[model samples]
Target: MRISLALLFAVVLQLPAENGYAQRTHVAISMNNVSVEQILNKIEETSDYVFFYNDKTIQKNRIVSVRNKSGKILDILDDIFKGTDITYTVVDKQIILSTNKMQLVQQEGQIQVKGVVKDAGGDPLIGVNVKVKDSTVGTITDINGNFSLQAKKGDVLEVSYVGYATKTVRVQNAQVLNIVLTEDTEVLNEVVVTALGIKKEAKSLSYNVQQVSNDEITRIADANFVNNLNGKVAGVTINSSSAGVGGSSRVVMRGTKSLNGNNNALYVVDGIPMSDMSAASTQPTDSYEGAGQSGDPISGLNPEDIESISVLSGPSAAALYGSAAANGVVMITTKKGREGRTSVSISNNTTFSAPLVLPEFQNTYGQTEVGSYYSWGSKLNTPSSYDPKDFFQTGVNVTNAASLSTGTDKNQTYLSLGTTNANGIIHNNDYERYNVTVRNVAKMLKDKLTLDLSFMLSSVKEQNMTSQGLYYNPLVPLYLFPAGDDFSKVQAYQRYDSERNLLTQYWPYSTSLALQNPYWITEHIKIPNHKNRYMATASAKYDFADWINVTARAKMDRNNERRERMYDAGTNTLFASKYGYYSKSNIENQQIYGELLLNINKYFVDNTLNLTANVGANFENNDYQSDYFGGKLKSVANLFTFGNVDTSEKNLANQYGYHLKKRAIFGSAQIGYKSMAYLDVTARNDWSSTFKGTNTGSFFYPSIGLSGIITDIFRCSTDIMPYMKVRVSYSEVGNSPDVFLAIPTYALVDGV
Candidate 1:
């Protein structure tokens, strides 16, 4: 039957508020005059009477109610369904019941059939679907394709394949029964993970989206996660940097949109999008630096902590996300809680790194001058790499991580921790990072609902000691002096260069403007920058009717960054007067989202279909505050030396900035049939704070996608081949980089 996907979605909207699955029940039954043989035979003809006294089937489908009196038939089954705390409906004697109650049917004779479902090359089909013909009796194969089913010696067993033809065998007394299903051309279809954690045949979906799984994911490492898709995607460019700690990479999809605002893509963890690049809000005026010195912020996240990541690069792919997804979005899925048994996982890894970019400098002649030339006054001079001996260059770095995971059937959790340290080839130039994380998921609503939560914390420290800007130039004329006969008293003239140029002739370790002593700067010239970060999120969902569900979510991310860069008065580096400078900044970011989802399903002829609809709202706010101070003190004190109440000149100032936003509504639908064809559409509107009242209006974006199953259409299954598939996708989203752009500007002048 052809149906509007909206109708199916409306039905799914009835799911409970929280996963609402009932507990299991127990029962035992003894047959009377009607022998077990007759009951089994009658089951085939009866349409209204359903029986469930079996041992190896759906646990919930097991009938706990029993019958002792003669043929009151309907009354007996009805009583069992209600009294045993089980639920089910009897349709024409065929028990349409809940999976919570298990059913078991018994046969007297012993029939053993055991075989492996391996590929043509003899590799086991770990998860192949297997079942008995003409009945609901079925079982999935183990990872090794090894299966064991019991039936009467004379009964015939049946096997069916998803992409292969059916096979039936009459059970004999033999101990082994092996079977194989060929990879047919008529069975190629990509299965995709969709809304509300469901899997659907790709052909039925109408929205424009793409999926990548299995072998493709295992081929990369933690740091290069996004880099692997460089040339494969249609509208994405992944750029790499060669800075400290392997400058994080950037991913730009489509073209840059939005005014002067940031067009960087948004990252969603599991289902949460919360993170901040560890860069400060302010930079030195004459410092010749970017607003943010660090690379992409998302790079700090541990890739091993992720199970799968899908890029919702278009409005159609992220319609449900509203305004936050205006530029684009990446949805991530983490490992989840499982049932039945216990599994343990442990992994240890290490990596080595080297700088990809470096700066060049001229290094010849020792500390000397022209007219006022001074050899190594009191000390002997030697040729070095940074000297006339410029024939050497070197670089090195290291990183490592360790993790463990173990969980029970009811509740599962994952934990990991790691550390990375890098050193630049430059003197005293380097960066280091340490991180830890814990994630947990629980079965709060039995089989219907579940809960997921995660927390992460990390710290980064960096040091850069070089003073070649101005001031501290030893190559200055006044500081120049002649060397001693033995060059033993060079220390006296060290601060006083002999051939020092007054204007700009000097080495990197000259003065602040002329290049100060890097060794002296590293020890006395300090720019101690440190950052601490924390992130968290919590959300819940419940099903109302079989087709309806409601969800509420809240998330937060906060970070503190502080830096103190100053010059100390020491004898070696340069002659310092009284001085000190420092700055501190605090940033806070938060977001909240709420939504409702409805899913509908139907089956007819040779096809099955599904529909989903959802409504939601999102709000985000970001704020930053900074404080700066500088002064001339009595003498050069250590970092902690000068307080706000210090010895001399004072230059204190503060700056504040903020961003607020809101997004209206979004919706999308997908359709599939016979598991071969797919189609989808998505749309959304948003309001941003970066734009002013006159221009801060709403924007709409949408996209469509189509796909086909080549294998299923061609019927290629045979004895020689095993598996193959092909797929492609295209989508579009909006861009609003300068949310705070297009505003009026003003000029100010000091009044006499």
Candidate 2:
């Protein structure tokens, strides 16, 4: 009968292709009130299903009301497991849930691993951490040093960081890892940081703290990086200021403990406290026709946003920062935000300077009086071509910087921008600056709280700023020209005076009027200086255990300055007066600070004694103001205003204001033994509203320290004497009495 009817049509097409995953795939459902794990994620989003269970055996937060418009997802999971003793099994596309009928499996020695964490010069070492050994399971490498975790193979990971050296491996099957570490050179030669930002260790430090780093302050790009720390610390001196390219530098650490107070130093950045108060022409007296050293306040920072620069050189390493460390303490440490994955850095610096010496002048003399400023005249036939190196000019310094760092692993960020332009071998003498910095770091609860916020902005503009003695200094008329004149014929210093309708001075030698007309005192004897600064900081830390911690910080630093000088009316009569001489001044400085710290770290005999403690409190407020009006220009020319000047009394206008408040309470303690002998102590108390009620208005500072490790007490041989330590300390810091000394002040006479 036709071959048995084709064998019953091939057994009915192989019986629905072997059961089609035990049938029942169609699934269309409508949800309401969700949860039964959202109806098993809406029946595994409508089809090829996948549900598994035992997140504590089903009951995925119950609550399910479903309507199956087209179902066969086992009839909507049998109306979502009817009386709910939960139980399901589909296997082929997975839907093996369980509750009473138990059957859910998936958990066999987890395994996901992945890694990277370099540093023995191979770079990449962002936050490190990487746990897994001993449980709480961890993670931290991002920002390029990658990482991911889930341990299994044989477990045991534990990488760490902070000066490195702390690693362990073993995760056999290897899903990817690369650690490197190494460099705990004895914990980086015994830590450091000190004075309030407190970190101690060099055998418990008893004084001499140095440390520079940030690759020694950007190696050698100095626009006043505290003059690059002169000889690199050892009593730290510095000096620097001939007013070239944004001047003012004066460090002085151990030697100058304040004779008349403020011997520089004291400029802590990250831990706040800043204000090298300068700008009173940076005080080096003998005013050469006015306004010179207007640079300080650490010459507007920005050493690529630093990252280290300690130097608490004395007062036993700055007796807890009281009285602004009394003349010791440079601190600094900026650049934060690391936990990685977003980074960009760019830098450029170009420098070319001249005149390393220049000052042996004597073009064989010439000019015994022909409009002479005496180069002692006479004997000059060929030597009088007069070349003080043709009056200098070949200084160029450019700097550009950019930075951005990104993070994750609980937030992080850091940004930076910098620009600088200089030129000064004197010809218009310029210097410009702009910088911006921002920082943010966050790590909430689980990380035990940590927050840091920062902002800094700076702008500076300078031009023709050089005032140190001879009338608005143009190197005092280019070194008293007249070696035989012809300095390129006055470089056209100005000429247009149909009888004083404007522009005059064309050089004719005046000598003692402090020589002017060095190209008309750099074109019109002007001096423009501008400064704008703002700093803000906020900090928070909270550990609450694991040896306790608590930190709180607040900071605000503000600055505004404007200084101007313009002398016109035929210049140099000790700075133009025939109705032309103008001066403008406005200086403002503000500081607000707040601190609270409490830190402790314990460990006893078993760990062989170790203590470490710190308690702090601080509050500071400072405000300074200066305003001045200038004289003479009641109209003889460049009409600069104080409303055109000329306010009598020989016209000298001035005003000043200052306010200060300081409060403190500090403490510190350190003890160590097995870590190789040490002891330290600190205490501070200060009050001063410049001595509010006498008895020196409250001051008490103390510091004590002792250390020993003469080759770890002779157990020596760190591969043939690696380090030997010894220290001793004693300190008592203090300094107060300056602004209006003890109040009762007066001066402003005529203006009154």
Candidate 3:
């Protein structure tokens, strides 16, 4: 028949890989209806031809004797593995048995599937279309929706796509799956999670990573989850401390990377590495008015134990993290181990936060005004209901939670416990805080051992209300103080200097006879604070083969602090003690980390290789201590006196510090050459004792990158914009600090 149609058109043309795309081949047959000469004698009873290709595979396994008509069954198994190096791929009616020999092999007894395809309020449903039923096997999913398929024995699976309803799975014995897909309100897609955790397809990322999940930080837990990420990211900026809600918030992710340290970033969690310091958040803007400053140590964490948050802005999106990431990096992912069928979740939502930005102040004058009224004209007292409705504005809140999850297929677990309480709107200027948190995740030795544990406890108490200190302090008596003198009779009559441009005094509150005593400085001042904290991490990973893997990590973070400043013994004028004064402070910090890692993965299927390799070694240690004391006492009977016959002149301070950082050498590499070409290389080295001499020591940082997937090498591969990729990266991190060698040179003094 015309030489069997010219050898099936020379085995349907083929080529692609050295940085392009296509490289497919196929040959599979396991039928209940075999013809075409019993599928060419079943590929000549399993390979090894020779001998005139075994009589042309037994005279072409007859279809009425080698097609007494034409040809099919894939042109007779493409002339039996055509060019003999054996390779394959066919995504409809399954068949992928590649072998060009660049190994990363794993195959075990058919029936397999590992899934992820979300929708119904859980968002994530890409390309969906997986099949098994009615022949023509299938597969499609990637871009975070992940997928892996292979089935046999009682197949019967059919999951359609293109929108809502279509599912029919019955392979019986399941294996790791998670699919939700619901909303197709006429196709609407938007999903992104690039750089490393690879889950692209959010229009194929060009440069932008800003995902904040976990229900938008539990609906902005009363601000301070990094201040609810202020105005949501565009050029990010947030500076706080106008005395509001637990005070202190200043995060600038993409600007001012450093003019003198304090420029921030690098705060990973779960993938471990948290604690970027200059003692994180310095608070101190008058603890939101009344009560010695405090608030902003990760704002006592607990945003439902976060689930995912990425903010790796600059340094080329954190050049594989080096040099403390140079003011950029905040990757955090927590919450796991779940396979379902044992779920218990209880959540509580609460809201009551006052102050959506307000600070205008000047309600038609209250604590006195208009000739400084007490009796107008010259200067004097203040009262008249000290009105303006006593400057009104208030706020309050409370929340609670609990969780539990379970799974099977060789185990899965997640446990959670939580609590929160808050109050603030200024009056007795109240603030009360108490919190407890616990998180656990386990996946037994079957999924290859994994366990993560988290625990937290917190406490806060505050008080503020002793009235009077108004009409904007210029020295007492702002308006009506003569008629029934409110806020303690008026003192030093209205003294006015209005910027003492130094000279004159129409004293209505201030003109310098020092009209002090704003209700005796908020009645007997008092400031108190106390805190304790701990954070941890422990790890172990082992695969040892199948592309190798080994890991070991241990981490710890600790904090303890105490502060008190109280004074009361009469000082209506610089000195008039009934006897009382105080100041005390103590602080401590500790951090430690250890690590070891190695990973490698390889797969090529003919010059469309994709490789990954990583190595690690790390050790870190830090400790700091501080103490201060101040005194003076006589009698309120000595508010717990501290004296050597007290009279004022009490000062004491102590500080201790230590740090040891060590990092061994390691090399990392990633190469791709097909599947849209790419290459990435990395190297690391460090040893610091805070650096000293020859202007710094032990350093080495290397990086290189390039990517180009351009629509899978352009002849356009799609199914709703599959992937795009186009990357360029360069890296060279640095940080050698002796902090300007802690200055103190001029060694010539040795001549003594």
Best by TM-score: 1
Query: Which ranges of candidate 1 are over 4 A from the true structure?
Result: 1-235, 254-260, 275-287, 290-295, 337-347, 355-402, 465-525, 544-548, 568-580, 591-606, 630-634, 637-651, 710-732, 737-752
Pitting candidate 1 against candidate 3, the one with the higher TM-score is 1
TM-score of 3: 0.31
lDDT of 3 by residue, 463-566 (tens): 44222233222223332233333443333323434453221212234324334344333334455566666776676667643346676767787777676656
lDDT at position 524, candidate 3: 42
Candidate 1 matches the true fold with a TM-score of 0.62
Q: How should the candidates be ordered by TM-score, best one leading?
A: 1, 2, 3
Worst 10 residues of 3 by lDDT: 48-57
Model 1, span 604-676: residue lDDT tens = 3322443444555555555544555554334433344445324343344345454555555656666654455
Question: Which run of 10 residues does model 1 get worst, by summed lDDT?
Answer: 17-26
How well does each candidate superpose onto the true structure, as a TM-score? 0.62, 0.32, 0.31
- Order of candidates by lDDT, top first? 2, 3, 1
**Model 3 residue 582 CA deviation in Å:** 0.8
Predicted model with the maximum lDDT: 2
